[model samples]
Target: MIFFLIFCVTSGFSTLLNQDTLDVIYRYVQKTPFKKIFERSGSEASFINEAIPTAYDSRAVYPNCKSLTSVLDQKKCGSCWAFATTGSAADALCINGIANVIPSPQRQICCDNKCLEIPLKQCDYGCNGGVLTAASLYIENNGIVSDECIPYEENSSKPCFTSCSKEGVKMEVYKGLYAKIPSIMKVSENEMKKGIMIGGSIAVAMNVFQSFTLYKGGVYNRTDGDFLGNHAVRLVGWNDTAEVPYWIMINSWGTEWGMNGTCYYLKGKNLGNIESQTVYFSTTPPTYHGRQVSVSFSLIFIFLLVSFTAVLYLLSYVCGRINEGEKKRDLQEKEARTQMLREIGERRYKRGLKNRSSSSVRRRRLSSSENEDEKDTSTRMIDDSEEEEESEKDIEKVGLLS
Candidate 1:
């Protein structure tokens, strides 16, 4: 059952997308006219202009930086704006020698309401769609947490969490400032390459076609399909020396799609408006000042220890009660058996006394019968004597008369 539930969740999360559904989602908002541009100083201008490479890739240049190489999935949600912003920020932090930590896109999706509250056309509206410049402003004003603190849920309705929910993870806020090249309009191809050379990786919005979704390999230049909505992606590097010049881009569609979640666009031509609205960040190392820990590990340990002790104490009390009940029952049973035996002995003694009284009555009746028989014998003898005496007298008288 657990495995089936996991499979269902995984399937729901990784559902593939088609062009017909992607067109209506409203994934990107164009830059607003009211937003200001960041004016670069002389040294910053010299740094960007000094780059001479005809072909460059941020992954090869910063091989040790995991942020540039790692690809993330947006997972059936239209929060590509969040992914592009957070991803580019992570790469910028690593390249600027600040810190290597992936900021949480979930925080922006749930917490930041700059675009929602303010009635601005260029601002973000959570997962419905967002502007890159507005998302960058959000990062600058209210910092975002690390992915370890609050992992991406790909959900727009999730409530904003004030503190980290993950156990044993320290909550840290990463703050940074952002800028867009030619802040008012779309950047040219040469300008986009220069920005890539200066910054490690940057965020850009482009029109997606149905054929672009089925891209497998090679430079994707097919403009044959119906126009899907605008999508946000990270612009990593470019190769101008190849037979067909192309720009390498990192997508938020997971590693299973395209060339390990990367796609190439035909360079020198603004196909799909690929060179438009480049946004990059300048970040600092994360600070551990705000809501560092929700519940300390020591507190958790103490709670568990107390709970275990209480359970043991409860079990001991219940067992003691059971033993006392058993002992009381055994004593009652022993007294009952003793009383039953005593009653049986008393009944036998009363029955023996009754038998002795019956024997005495029978003996008295026999004695009376013997006495009557002796009396009868004596009376008979006396009668016989009297008769004999009378006969003797009669004989004497008769002799005298003669």
Candidate 2:
């Protein structure tokens, strides 16, 4: 069964399963104006001008940002905007050496109503899909807590709790600063590379099609598929030398789907308008609200080293004790076998002696009986002869006795 499943995946027959997931994705990504009115803001210009490179990867540059590198699933909600915004914010924080905090997409998606309270008419569309740039704006003003704060609920209808973003129990506050950039201007190979080189993930949206859902590996180029809907994703890096030269994107469909929850889109092609619309975020320094212990990477490394040494020592001790027990058991078995053999030999010797003694006793009894019989016969004969001689004087009595 597993082999059949693997074969189906390899042969692209798993599109049936992927179609269902894509349907869910399409249904939730409700239409929004971000794509219509997206424009590069003043805040993003400085970051873009800061760095320029040919090729770059966030994982290579910032190893501490596991929250940035790891794949996340938006599930059956239209919260890709929140996920992308929060994800980029987290990476920016790590790159800037602020905090390795995975900000709550749930908070941004469900609890971020600060925009609603604003009179500027800037507000999130909620689960019906919102603009990453707009959401980043709200998050910047009112900092978001960690993912553990609220925890993303797949059901969008779930009420946003006020007590969700708690300190110590959940996470510390991670502030955000929004920067919107026109993805079209950076569609050029060098332009995108320069944008990515600055630091942090790039929040971008693309027209997700049927073929995209079934992407297993290799640089994906549009071959055949109808436009489904606009879906948000985080651009981490890109490969320029592939058969199709693709941008390595972190998808939100869980790690099990789409190249282990990541996909490669054709770079420079801008298929699905991916290169035309992208957003990036900058993070302000973190502010702790309550008592919390933020362990440094050095401390974590030391702890791991100590744990590994202790485990190695324990294993060595256990193995040594096992070897000793095996040796002792082998010796006991050898002694038991020797004792059994000795007992068998002694029993055989005693039986032989008993049999020999019984035979000797029988022989002696037979010999004595034979001698007695012969003596009796001789005495009878002599008595007969004496009786015969006496019979001459009193033969009648002797003859009568014979």
Candidate 3:
């Protein structure tokens, strides 16, 4: 059953990979004015560049507090909307150091049933896209929506649909299939280093090419490829200083995107704004959500009684087992330590014996594998050369006598 379901989902997602679909989507992006508008606005990127302080910061708040982990995919999928909304939520959580790892954009994209907000017509999965901020606003106003309620889906397959319903949220409108991700570009070593040092309101530039499909660790060369895919990253920190510096940037394409789990951007200049951006946060949470879940005091008392009893018994058993395990582990560790000491002592004694012995010179010359191989090769060559010399000398003496 699980395999069948997995197969169905995989097949559904694969449908988006149709060549005609891809060409159409690519054409749409190429023809779209959004990229061109953003290109002209050096100061304000259409999707990102407008900077602001993080949401949780009380001192100075900026509009468009986006998720540090959610990159601006623009018009990629309905998932972009989840990304936008979650980015806002994550900004609030991250700035406060409350939590990281923004909730899945997949969840919001597939699950939220509020159609009036998330129009059913425009967001069917194609190369076409939508906004995430609206959906996040809905979640904030309403309670948690379960994946069981929603299920994982491929937006590229069907037109975006409201699969689940909530009592608090209405069908008239849901968050769009995408949202704007305001970014602060860190283009240079100086600016990037400052963002890493300060660690706030920083967006790192990324090149999304075919090779960027699966990222491993290490510093990469931006000059190597065309940098076909453009995205923003969150600055984490700097690594090296000896030759050129490396900047640690967090990618929103899950932990799978770069540097094993991170990416290093070699320095460039004014690729985007490293300074001059601000962020914002909501002062009050949305009305339907944010309030604590209601539970009766009567139920609470009974729950407390049962929970305390269970916990007490569980702790006692765990403690008793732990104590027994510790006793055995301590004995084993002591035995292992003693064995190690004995081996060390034997090595020292052998060293002393070698030093006192006449054969110490031979031992000294072949201490390691590298020296041993060299010695063997050299010894054979010398022996062969000596035999050749003796044969030549004997022949010369014989010739002279003859």
Candidate 4:
């Protein structure tokens, strides 16, 4: 993968055939030191939210679009259609007053398996891939599944029976809202707050270019891959700030893939920002505003990371000292043991009158014991020096305030 990624960087395309966008993703992934950086990448929240932090991935709902609140698949198989269909069904159900619940992809693959014209291949539905629209259309025609009757039988080798179809159910489709604006920053917070709780999906339009791959990190003016994803998303709402009006959009990728699992369209560049990875996502408006209650929660996350790091350093310090102390005690014990052994050897030598030439091994062991004490002292000095340096970092450098 590393060789292929570098090759894509040099060639301005990926070897994944048509998956050139993946090359851009590779560039960013290679450079990313932290996998979870995007979670904290959004602009600082307003004073209210700044006091608290929000943990919701921000994309998990819709803006007055009737959130389906259904289960989402993370591409366990190339069966994107199942996720999309199940997702759209959740939206449709909420519109029809159905409660939020987990949907089964197994029913579609098991009962219908769509046409099943060709014999099953070894890799079928086993993360190789499948059509998402087919899954949605199949669900629409065959109706949804029951977990007890047809739970998720993902990546199944056996194809489903043809007669195991559910009766197709009718659904209502609600068109998502869209508006052209000079800037997204112009959207007011009051206007944006309610969109989150309403629950819906959104689609964004952009000029997608090849450089969109570089959207992974740092900054980019252009990408080096083909546009391969959607730009539409749910409009949860807006930040009211006149300085930086931004609409938060969620994408169907993981948190490591983009914008801490969400995207913020910069005020001027939200449009035609293919190189910027402007993509679509969903969320609810009221829930969006309500998130402000814990806006300052980001600080807590930062505090936890710092605290954990400090504790690790503290443990190393304490452990090092304890280890050194133990080594010192062990060295003392060893010297005592060697001295007792030497005394016994001397007494025996005296009683038997053994010649020096025969007792050479004992003599060398005694000499080694003497050198070990010297090495121990040297190690002790080095450790004491390290302790002094660490103590210095803990002290604040004071300046004379005149």
Candidate 5:
């Protein structure tokens, strides 16, 4: 009875674990758009004539291009589309002689908002999720900025400035032009190998399983785990000579995952539909010497000349107005002074006339007073003389009478 009870408990736990794994697989399979996987373009014919190698690795071929060997981390954001696209483009640029530049995945994620405009299975919703083809098209047309221009932001809310944010780096200098991807095509396994050899690296999509996440090393061929969602990665090379025959892939899960952020998928079977779609780009190196620079310089020179002329004309006009105002003010001040001086002279003349009139009045009053005093004196003397005569006459009579 004890043994039977233990067997029952073990069976029950196994059933529960199986059920959980089925649930995870069901969710991933439901999320994948299976219809898009079958869509094919006939561009594989272009590479049919090229010789195919048994095993090739871009890192071994282009030893100087560090981007081909370096593994980037996408963090928690679902920005694998941006990283894969930009990584493949960077490898191509370095392989073509434009050296030492890793294109900005952040720029692609934030700035390329027109992914929805292009009719694709999925739209690029930044960190939420995105389509691979839409990202490739953006790099082809708009041309991506260098990683030095804008570093990757794990935050989904990062905004697009569309300009170089790094100090001492001009947007025009690092931001290149004429990034060309002849075509975005879905090809067979052999065709994908030829494409990688012809071009440096190719961006490819694959379905991820739960077991893929825990993968540490070895040629990964396990398809017996919980199916995760689709992921985008760079297909750098492949080895058909291996026991399982695997395609070399560079992942954006950081160097700690897999074999230093690299993995191997079963090549011929297209186990994760990696060969279903692929993209590559080629660009001409920018030249600072030649007609392009001359035209840019000419435009700049013309702009400076026009600006300088406008400033000079404005200064001259202002100076002329100021001089005219100063001259008018001086004339007005001079007129006021002349008027004031005239008024002062008039006041002085009026004051002089008033003083002369007062002097004449004083002289007349003095002369009239002197004349009256003289008249009084003369009258008193006359009266005294008359009295004296009368007294003398009386005295004479008295003496005669005595």
Candidate 6:
């Protein structure tokens, strides 16, 4: 399955599909209409005078600038202009050492819609398609809040509230951090690199094709493909040492769609007119008013939780000790009662033995006295019988003499 998907993406299977299907697949990129292209034109000096450097690369000098890069997902909305604008601004802030504050793209786009009196549509209305130059102008006039203040939801019908800066709800928004594009110039390959070196990332538009959506890696140049539309992106850095010289462009589709949410376009080829629509901007230092309070609240919550758990543990330990003492007392009481009962039983047994010995001696003395009385009575009876026999013999002799 993985191989099949790879084959499908790498083999330009999307090019075989109908235009409508291709539109559905590649609708995330919304470029300005061709009629509006003339709205932003640069002097010939910016393009013709700059020589395309043969072996120069900005990434080598500014290796940490990639950390300033922000990748976004337009999702179902066509907010590429907003993403490109805010993403470049964010990189500028990071490059300037204000890494904590990331400007909100939704706020930039939504506010631009409000300014243009454009009703937002899910597909291609306000956020669906917009010009990055217009968005930059809006940001410059009415600065936007941080992403934390107004997060991107990818919803167009949702109401755009006046930011805290405008509404004065709270002093959580800083207006000094908005970026401005004072000039937009048609730049050559070297001019684009110089713009990146001067200003972190610059927003550029390119012609997108169906095969472009399936771009995996390496230098990309559409030699043959179906043209869909012009899409906006932020060109951060480039590498000439690669297999093919490529311009590192960050897309708004997602990280999963490209090489870490970045695409490598073939450098110096003017493929998709990537170098033609490049523009540079100057940024103000970012301010993060809400981030401080959020960090404080988080610390307080963690402290309270730890304190509560410690109190609970202390109570458990005290209760367990009390129970142990009670159990020990109960065992001691039981042992004392058993010992008392054993001593009482021993005393009763000794008394019973003593009484049995005294009763036996008394019975023996009474039996000896009764035996002596019986013997005397027997002797008295024998003498009385002998006397009666002698009287009877004397009376018989006197009768014979008469």
Overall local distance difference test of candidate 3: 0.42
Which parts of model 1 are misplaced by more than 4 Å? 1-39, 116-120, 283-402
For residues 1-402, what per-residue lDDT tens digits would candidate 3 score against the true structure?
644644465456444332222222222232244234212222122223334222122112322323453343424343533443444444544454544433444555544544321112222222233322234334444423333334334454444445443345333322211112222222334433333223333433334555555446665544343555444345544545525545445555555456444566553433223222212233222111112211121233345555776798799999999999999999999999999999999999999897778466656755666687888899989998998999999999999999
For all candidates in order, the CA lDDT equals 0.69, 0.64, 0.42, 0.41, 0.69, 0.60
Query: C-alpha displacement of 15 in model 5, angstroms?
Result: 58
Model 5 per-residue lDDT at 25: 24
lDDT of 2 by residue, 59-170 (tens): 8888778776688788778888888878877777778787777767887777665432211233566688876546655555566677777777765565665665455584
lDDT for 81 in candidate 1 is 92
Regions more than 4 Å wrong, model 2: 1-51, 113-123, 159-161, 165-171, 183-191, 283-402
Model 5 worst lDDT window (10 residues): 19-28
Error of 5 at 33 (Å): 25
The best candidate in terms of TM-score: 1
Whole-model lDDT, model 2: 0.64
**How does model 2 score by TM-score?**
0.54
lDDT tens digits by residue: candidate 1, 1-402: 644644454445324322211111111211332112212244445555575578999989998777788888988888999999888877777787766777788888887665322222455677887877677656655666778899888887877778886888878876654443344345876667766665688888888998988899999987768888999999889998999999899999999889999988888777888776777765321121112211222233345556776798799999999999999999889999998888888888777777777777777777767777767777767766766666667777778889
TM-score winner between candidates 1 and 5: 1
Candidate 2 displacement at residue 319 in angstroms:
99
* lDDT, candidate 6, 1-402, per-residue tens: 644544444346333433222221111112323213123224322443566455543445555654344566888777887878777766655565655365676676555653321111212245568765556545544555677677778866665656543343342443333333322334566657766765577888777888888888766777467888878998878878777888877788888987988878888778877776655544422121111223332344355555776798799999999999999999999999999999999989898888888888778877877777777777777776776677667677778888
Better of 2 and 3 by lDDT: 2
Q: Output the worst ten-in-a-row residue range by lDDT, candidate 6.
A: 21-30
Model 1 worst lDDT run, 10 consecutive residues = 20-29
What's each prediction's TM-score?
A: 0.59, 0.54, 0.32, 0.31, 0.56, 0.49
